[model samples]
Target: MSVELNHTIVHCRDNRESAEFLAHILGLSTGDEWGPFIPLVLANGVTLDFATIPAGSITVQHYAFLVSEAEFDTAFSRIEERGITYWADPHRKLPGRINHNDGGRGVYFPDPSGHGMELITRPYGGWPEGSPVVPGS
Candidate 1:
């Protein structure tokens, strides 16, 4: 059997708000509930389970997505259109600049819950020309 990532649980103060925030930024749909979670599943079939929690009880986490050059352009445009700030590095020091690491573009931002959201075109290693690079690969 092959192992694959199915979903991840995200604890938030407001599940709906957090789910909507992530869906809006990542260009996904929200408002869908599964059991006790408001899920925002991406095109890759990985669901971000937004679960509600008590007040002042949420820890920030980091999640990254690998996107294509075209998708990166579109998502980056959406990010700017939504007035969301982005940074080149994960440390968030180089604000408003996209990274050109591995000969592809990448940007890092934060979600409503202060979770680090990242979109990268290339992985740590480089990809050959003509190879399809899906978002959040």
Candidate 2:
């Protein structure tokens, strides 16, 4: 059997807002209701289930997306257009910048719920030519 990730619940202060925020970033639409939460399904069929919770009761989580170089460019542009802060490193040492890690570009930012959102073309380790340093490297 081929196993694939389907969905995961994202506890947020406001489900609709969180869903919309993720949808906007990923260039997807806020999907219709599925039980008690709002969902944003990716092209890969992985849905982000956002559930509303009491204020100050939500915890921060990290979610990374492996995108193509072209998708990275487009998403980075969107991030910039929205004036959202971007960091080349996970520690947020170098702000407002992107990294050319593993011969590919990557960036990190936070979502509305304070969840760490990352976009990377390369995972880690060795990369091709002209690869940018993974900040602090």
Candidate 3:
């Protein structure tokens, strides 16, 4: 049997809003809420379970997604349509720009809960062909 990550809880100010926001960007649907969690499952079966926490208790978190070129285009359009600010780099110094790293596009933006969200078409440093650990490995 291979080990896999099933899910992770994302602490947010509002679970429903955060979950819905990500679901829309990824062109996915939110799953039914279970208790305090509002889950957004990815294609790999890894769920991002959003849970509400006090706004004061929330800290900055970074979430990155490896997306296809078409998916990136759609998501980036939504970001622009929503008037969300984005940057080519994580520090957000390069505003209104996108990065072509490893021959793929990437952008960084902040979610409503202030989480640093990233969408990239290629893995940093390129895909790991023989690394000990790859995504979903």
Candidate 4:
């Protein structure tokens, strides 16, 4: 009855690697392999179908995920454990740090395919009253 995002194709150098990487970070499991895709379904019912493509042909994309504070803590620890470089801001001026924007925590990191992955505990517009609106945090 209403428009919804069902699935999206994420082009990566290796579908299985991309899918597994994201699954580990999100604490989720990937769906069974099908054709050229390795599906990673979200709690909201959206499926990210990773497909292997030529590295030169893949255009890195930015994917932002809004997670609970607990989830953020868990995922952020995994990021550090893996020694992944992260930034407090999207511009990446502050490396090895996270942002406290909108009264919540967030970090930006790159996926194996070079896609920009963002994890935030609060939506940008959900800032508390009297808090300054932060752009690109």
Candidate 5:
């Protein structure tokens, strides 16, 4: 009846490790391995199927997640605990810090596959007043 994003393939050096890394950071559960894929499904029902590929086969991709404030706190804590270097800017100009953009907190970090991963408490430009932005809508 309508278009939807079911899943996407993410090329990584190690599927299991990459999937687990993202799942843990985002506080999501890893799905059972299917064939060569290790999946991490989001709350919106979109699955990221991680697949092991040759080294240097994938170009760096950017993934941004709009999380709740509580989720952002938890994930940011984990990032600090693991000593993962982060930046306030996507260009990585401001190192060792998170940004407060659109009146919400956000941080950018790299996954094991070198993909840029971001977590923000607000959507870009912020959601309109008196309305909510549904994920995957």
Candidate 6:
């Protein structure tokens, strides 16, 4: 057997809302409620198990997804349709824009739970030697 990401718990003010938000944006489906969790499984089989908690008790988290260009286009359209604020940089210095970092498109936004969300078409380390480098790459 090899090591692989299986699942992770994400604390949200409303598990269902958070799960549904991400699912709708990514064009995925959520599993039936199990215990306190609302599961959203990724294409790679990694499930993000959303659980409800007090809003004040929830800690911020960051989740970055490497997506195909088509998936990015679809998800980005959904974000724009919802008027979600996005940035070209994770630090959020550049607003209302997406970065062509690593020779691919990337954007940073926030999830319903306030978790930092990122979508990129290319892995940071896969960038060509002369490609523009984004901070933290």
Q: Quickly count the clashes in candidate 2.
A: 1
Tens-digit lDDT track of model 6 for 1-137: 99999999999999999999999988999999999999999999999999999999999999999999999999999999999999877777778888787678888999988999999998886434443444422
User: Which one wins on lDDT?
Assistant: 6
lDDT of 2 at 113: 80
lDDT of 5 by residue, 1-137 (tens): 79999999999999999999999899998999999999999999999999999987988899999999999989988888898888877888677878777777778999998999999888878434433222211
Better of 5 and 6 by TM-score: 6
For model 2, residues 1-137, the per-residue Cα lDDT tens digits are: 89999999999888998889878877779978777799988778898899998868888888888888788877887888888988887878788778887676788898888888998887868534554555422
Ordered by lDDT, highest first, the candidates read: 6, 4, 3, 5, 2, 1
Ranking 4 against 5 by TM-score, winner: 4
Q: Weakest 10 consecutive residues, lDDT, candidate 2?
A: 128-137
Looking at model 2, residue 88 earns an lDDT score of: 80
Structure candidate 5, residue pairs in collision: none
Order the candidate numbers by TM-score, best to worst. 6, 4, 3, 5, 2, 1
Single out the weakest 10-residue window by summed lDDT for candidate 4.
128-137
Clash numbers, per candidate: 1, 1, 0, 0, 0, 0
TM-score of each: 0.84, 0.85, 0.90, 0.90, 0.89, 0.91
Off by over 4 Å in 5: 126-137
* Candidate 1 clash figure, as a count: 1
Ranking 1 against 2 by TM-score, winner: 2
Q: What are the lDDT scores of the predictions, listed in order?
A: 0.79, 0.82, 0.87, 0.87, 0.85, 0.88
lDDT of candidate 3 at residue 31, scale 0 to 100: 95
Kindly list the per-residue Cα lDDT of model 4 for residues 1-137, writing each as its tens digit.
99999999999999999999989998999999999999999989999999999999999899999999999989988888898888877777778778787678889999999999999998986534443334332
Q: Determine the C-alpha RMSD for candidate 6 after optimal superposition of all C-alphas.
A: 3.8
Candidate with the larger lDDT of 1 and 3? 3
Point out where model 4 deviates above 4 Å. Answer: 126-137
Judged by lDDT relative to the true structure, which candidate is superior, 3 or 4? 4
